[model samples]
Target: MFETLPNARRCAVLIAASLAAMGGAAPAFGQAAGQTAMPDSKAGAAKPKLWDARPASPNATINLVHLLVKQGVLTEDQAAGLIKQADDEAYIARQAAKAASTRADEAAKAANAAAAASEPKGTRHVTYVPEIVKRQLREDIKREVMAKAEQENWASPGKYPEWAQRIRFYGDIRGRYQGSFFPTGNDQFDALHFNAVNTGSPYDMASPYNLPTYNTTQNRNQIKLRARLGMEADLTSGFNAGIRIATGESNSPVSTNQTMGGGGSNFSKFGLWLDRGYLTYQAWDRNLVASVGRFDNPFWSPTDLVWHRDLGFDGFAVQGRYAVSDSFTPFGVLGAFPIFNTDFNAGTNLAQLDSKFASRDKWVFGGQVGFSSRFDSYRELRLAAAFYDFENVQGQASQPCYVQSSSDICNTDQTRPLFAQKGNTYMLLRNLQVGSWNNFGTTSLYQYYGLLQQFRPMTVSASLDLGDFHPYHIVLDGEFVWNTAFNRGLAAAGTGLPASVGITSPGVALNNRAASSDGKTVGPFNGGDKGWMARVTVGKKEIRQLGDWSVHAGYKYLESDATVDAFVDSDFGLGGTNLKGYFLGGSYGLSPNVWASLRWLSANNIGGVPYAVDVVLVDLNAKF
Candidate 1:
């Protein structure tokens, strides 16, 4: 047994020597690493001390105890007790190791699960693509995309051509059926007397003794069409060019409607005129813009009561807007327009009499300053003050043209052209000699001396938009215009004229010249040169899509001298000033950009003869 177990043999030798030296008594052995030696027994003790034979190594001790029991040197009960204690300690240690390994496995599993949760969805894909190739792929996708942009020529396309991408086309067409009703009495048309017989004589003070044989007031109905085509191109950075053409007669500054039955129901072709052709440049980070060419009016016109909608200015304009905050902005506008040009070529010699005479060209200069603010997303306000000054728009009232051979009749057919229109009161510079006509010595007819009254008009306009009204919004707008020159007070103090020369009497006749009290200058209409208007519109602000609607109803009072007659509302009071009326209109959208509208204007003369006119229009309007 000792040869089979080296440690057991070594421990057995130590114990045997200890017992021999102690005279066969239980010897006191030195304690092992942890166990205390059993107390020494008496020299003649009945049993030997077993713990003295215990070894430091557990396996060695177990082997020695088993050997002693097998050789019958120790009892079975004693050996079994030592073996049982050793087995119990080994079982506890094995269970502790298993518990630690389970804990480590659980921790490793938790870490792996946490790593999986942190990763992005889908299987991880790794690629070795070059940086340049990846960047090119991104750019290619970007270039191929044109969502939310205009796509032209849809016949064949994933997208429009490169050049086509920079251009946009849009237009509108309107067809209108208009009915005009006028007063039926002849007194309104043939009330005044013209003195054709007497030279240098005042108009005949004729009574209404001989009424006209027929009622001359004619009510007419007509159909008219208006078409427009326009294009805009983005040139570069902040610059753009635009052009528009419309159906109208050239130089007809007020109306763009082409009447369908002008010459006895012939298939008349419409005349296309250049409406707008302009180049615009945006500066100061796109807050300031300047435009040159024939362009839309640059002034802020809240209503057509002051400036007509179709009136385009042929010149240059500059506009600027500065934002002080998110809701407040100030703006300014300046413009110069050429109304007419009169430049004639002639040599410096006095031999040619007709060559050296030419009227100065007419020009109009305008300026405006204003500010706008938004209270919130639902309300806004705009206010502006504007001034317009006209140059070379004045002429003598009796601008008569005479021939050298025929001096008696003063040649009524030969008359100098004067800028006469419906709204303006053309002043007659009576007997004021001008060099353009042949020297006829001073007895010119009033029609020949019809001078365009140079108007310096100042205007104030404002609009308040109440957007929160939802389906029924409200807009209140007001405009005031004062023509400083329209009703110029006549200095009639010196001429020997009658005291009863009122604006309505036969002394100031409609046919011939109405001499001023001083026979020098004639005043405009009786009232002063001031006009004002206020309007309210309650409806949808815009009709953008299908099922959308908008409506407006307003009244206007336009005095004769309020604004230039040629530029005032063309549809109001038959296109002139000194008119008061009410207008109601409404529109219904068919598609996003197509709609129809109806409007009616009921007007009457303000202070003149008893004349009333009513106009109704039904229109179909479309845009793209």
Candidate 2:
């Protein structure tokens, strides 16, 4: 029966047989193989037969034969014969498909040739990119690569580490030529070297010629240098840290200038002191800042009448500012600074016994509240009121003690100030027994002196900037301070009369304690408690570029005890209080981050004595 069928039917039967061998089944085949079938009514409503559902393809014919064999309608011998004929039909179909594919490819080639012939001769379609466009593309690619390199920190391997990106470095250097002119008739012997005496062993009053005194009538000239280097780092979580080192002759809080060849003069190297070391935290988006360790002054002052510019406070400070509007900002600062700390073993006797002294730690607790206003884009004003209270800074007199030997220590000797810069009234710190000086060969006592008046100053400062002329504006700044803790009686009795002659006076002591016709004393012993300063500056506020310039003139009147002498400006009158002076200075930019300045300061004793001095300074400064 298979030999009688056509080749197409044979090929279809072979495909069906293969499908049946691979486990294909149909409902019709199942029924034919004696499986349960659907009823006639359901079969009439059913979908088309499985063979009719397939497309009219070779597989359809194969499926018909596969069902016959699966349902036992055809034998295995017949299915084998159908498969042989199907293989032959498949070979012929493949040959026809190859010939048709070749003809289609030739047609595509002929169409492309016709299209090319229609174009003009020697004409071609080419994208001509401009050089600028090419350059832009290259730059864009380079920028992307660089950005990735920076983010991954491999732009230049080992050249700069990852952490270095968060740090900034800055520094400045200054060289100055200064001349100090001292006029004739200035008192030479009365200006005691208080700092030197207090810091070392007490001076023996029996040897009057051996006492320490300041240079009063000496005119001198010297060169000086000041250099400072600092670094700041951005730490995690809104914290910042900074450190600075500066050159100075000594660890003086008011000045960082190193006098050329001053200490032993053999071309010695200058010493570097820790100028600032601080850590700060910005809380609430920089609305409040808190700092610890030695840091810059937290308060705002118009002048250096109370605090020197180079002074660093050792303690903690908090600063807060709020912008009520675009034109007005109110700010406040509170700080606690440790001026001096008592040693752990404050007093040690000659017998190797430790009798600890009470803690005489000195501190300054200060606060300032102020507001800044901008009336216009070119005009502004600032006003501040502040109070600084010095704690445990006043000296106390010691109990009477018998000095049997040079090694005998006074009980309250530690009350003496560790450092001083004159102008304040002083009294003897130690009271010796009546016969204790027999071994010293004189009745005069060997003792140290301490400041008589305390310092708790109230200061008000103001600044007015009239920048209506833009860069060539004028600025007016002024400050007034009054010491609330000063006592007239104590200051007068401490250094005024002959009856209270044991007190040590600054400047010209004899002239201050002038004897009257009736043997009474009259002088400026009523130490003043008020100080004020005013200055006006014209032109640019800062020297930022070449040809920029600024000039300023100022007058200062600081009386004794108005403020701590050790903390005021160190350049005027060479330093200290009880002096009135006028200064003029101007600076011109030499280049970016570099400038030259000249200043003249003429100062004279406000009272007590006629000591006068004039200073001239020329400086060259650079910053990086």
TM-score on alpha carbons, each prediction: 0.63, 0.73
The backbone clash count of each candidate, in order, is 8, 3
Give Cα-based local distance difference scores for all models.
0.63, 0.78
Model 1, range 254-373, lDDT digits (tens) per residue? 787878876435786767888889999998998999999988888888888777887877899999999999999999999999876654642234476653544556789999999999
Candidate 2 regions off by >4 Å?
1-150, 156-161, 350-354, 404-406, 436-444, 494-500, 503-526
Candidate that would win on lDDT: 2
lDDT (tens digit, per residue) of candidate 2 on 488-551: 7675553435433433332122223322445434454635888999999999998989999999
